[model samples]
Target: MDRRNIQVGDYMAVTSKLPNLVSSTTAIYNNTNCSEIMKTGNPKVEIFLITLLTCVFIFGTIFNSLAVWVFCFKMKKWTETRVFMMSLLFSDCCLLFTLPFRIYTTQHPWPLGDSWCNALLSVYFMNTYMGIAVITLISMDRYVAIKFPIKARTLRSPKKAALACGIIWLVYISIRLYLALGAKWRNGESCFRKDTVMPLKRALYFTVFGSCLPMVILIFCSTQIILTLKKKEKTSMNEEKDIKKSISIVKTNLAIFLFCFLPFSTGNIVRFVIESIGSDCSLIKLINDIYYAAQGLSDLNCCLDSICYYFVAKEFWEKASLFPRFKKQLIKDQTQESSI
Candidate 1:
């Protein structure tokens, strides 16, 4: 009877643990499957990304270099606009600096040491957010200058703009340093390729603050500026042409900003969803492709930013000697308020 009791107790214990064992096994299987799917390369997607990045690198380098020359050497007067343009240019250059390394890593494993890989990635992400923050600042500055010209006289200045940019740089640098110190590098890890798992908190924070907040601020400021400009146009007939030009420039800037950054933000959200739910191989592959394409699109921002420079800065058009036929007209249309 005692022996029977012992056997029954053992059977009950084993039965109680069965569900946990099965769950752990299933979890392992899912993780392994996801990793395998991510490791498998898609040649078409790879080729597309490589081609896109190469073009971006070439164009971005030339455009941003010209911007640097105009902003630094050609532009004589220091104003809030120049300060912001310089900040934006700095961020673009940083991103461009990482492109060659990124292009190389796309097809080949990172021959550089793990430290170099981490540093490059840190610079890339750091400047990406930095660029977004500076663009937001530019929009806010424009809105204030246009919406309330009197207050802008005191509120907006080159020194203040420089201070604001300094704060942005400091904040991003600190964040990157903290992340680098805390990050754990796995052996044989490839640059720009990591595990399928996304940290819930970090991803949420980045999506909300890094992308969503900037986008919202940009849209709001742009809408207010446009409406204000339209009202001004109605009140002042003599300035109608300038107002129309201003509206066109604002719309173009906003559209370019959205087009470049939207894909990467969307990919981030989708990746988070796929990770939260147990991995579907199809979804994994799709997300991987999205990521590749999105990265190329995001890098394209460095090139498109030149458009903003041309329209926003009077010196850019005047000193760069671009579009000579329209230079006089542009100089007239780009009044203090219109340029801002």
Candidate 2:
């Protein structure tokens, strides 16, 4: 490499012209091809993502909001289970409120400065951990209810559940607050989606403490509950219908939990492994993409839970039957109109 007496302007020209000097024509062809492909295909992907995200946001926000409202106002009786359910609703709503941020980010560049981005990222991680905590609580609640109904009835109160959920929030916040504060805005992406060492470490921690550990607890508690139910059926010589109902509830709940969580956990695991390996195959990429889609759907389970609980909580349905005010009013209105 010989030093040249070339002027700064000449050097600048050469540097700027470097692209034109080497393979520039080929690069242009490739770029043009990419642009055409994107123009034709990218819109479909964008449209699909937009529609999917919109539905998720609408249903999750409405249902979780409704669940909170019902728990607060309509349901006078609050049990430990109800309290845990409310905690889940709160966690879901935290993410639900931020959906618009994500939607806007997908379409437009990030307008909110680093401060809002960091704050929302914190909320995103904090509530995600809280959701795991609530799910664990729900599983434990069911276990206690089935395994030691009498003891659960005595020791487990909504106040205790509320206190536990509060502690979970504090822990979740503490674990993530440092990272959130440390977030750098230079990435120009949603802080949550951006991959960084701190984020990866936090995600792995969540995979263990928030997902895997809770999953263990859930499985153990759910198994114990099922066993207890089985014993009750055998010992009491319970009615076939009662035994079937109990089994059905347990199966349905277990399925719901696993269905919503397993894919997300798998995705996290894949992420961890990929980060560790630092290379990926097409299959791995596909799995990751599927996991991302599945996780989005899993998050939507907050809305699905409204439907699940509406059906699963037979007691709720029975109570609704008792309060026929709306039903009777509609019937009366119909009769009056018929008379006319």
Candidate 3:
């Protein structure tokens, strides 16, 4: 048998070695909280994770880059949704920047050195939480816009949205800054450092704030938005468009939470519990595999968000349509002038 050390979350790992436990039925413990290093080396896991991260990084970068350009240049009118999405786009880019290092680390040593590794990991973790925050805020914004369109005007302003995003970035950077400075370093599969005891607890605390709490807020806002939409009938074209946009935003954010995010987040919590219970190494292996897979799925949110948040927005595609229309008109005019 092979000995594998799995660190779930930050430092939730087996510090002790588990070898040939299959033959023994007797329970054994050096300490109730004794950390053991369980042997788990899965090349297939690294391959799959790298593949997923690569795809997400490529597509996410392109889509989000275009979104940023459009929001900054072409899309003039600023709505709460647009402002929130711009913030999300920046967060996605930060995550995207970390993927190349992650993929590189899958096959090679950490080339950028320990200091850069720490910085990169901080960027990765920080942006992930930042996205969670922005998504939760957008969900609430949409709910208010739909439920109380008139009253929401005061609540939904570009200035206020920018302020919220500023706060999110500021707070997130502060927390991650501390982690990067303090986290222990080593080369690993994901390019993130292995967690020790203190770091693992910190990771858990961050996860609760970043994923768990935001998830609750998203679920509530989504429910309210859906109910409000269902209650009111779309009497006009504008209302129909409003309804569609709201639904798109809701479903997109919900999909990110329920599908991409929820799995890994659930895995993180479960793995922590099982590790504390001192389960079989084989069982631990299974949980570790699930956690890795869930992590890949969570990364998929960057790609999927482009569809739900950017492409689905009429303003985005509509403005993009203008270039083609303008080109066609120019061609038509030149042909007529040449013929004359």
Judging by TM-score against the true structure, name the best candidate: 1
Tens digits of per-residue lDDT for model 2, 75-158: 777766567777777788888777777667655656878888878877766776677778778777767766776797686788
TM-score of each: 0.91, 0.73, 0.78
Model 2 whole-model lDDT (C-alpha atoms): 0.64
lDDT of 3 by residue, 38-104 (tens): 3234688878988899899889888887777777888889876678888888888889888888777
Clashes of each: 0, 0, 14
Worst 10-residue stretch by lDDT in candidate 3?
331-340
* lDDT on C-alpha atoms for all candidate structures: 0.83, 0.64, 0.70
- 287 Cα displacement, candidate 1 (Å): 2.0
Clashing pairs for predicted structure model 2, backbone only: none
In candidate 1, position 104 carries an lDDT of 83
lDDT of 3 at 213: 93
- Per residue, candidate 1 scores C-alpha lDDT tens digits across 275-336 of 77756767767886787788789899999999888788866777877778987887765544
Q: Which candidate do you rate higher for TM-score, 2 or 3?
A: 3
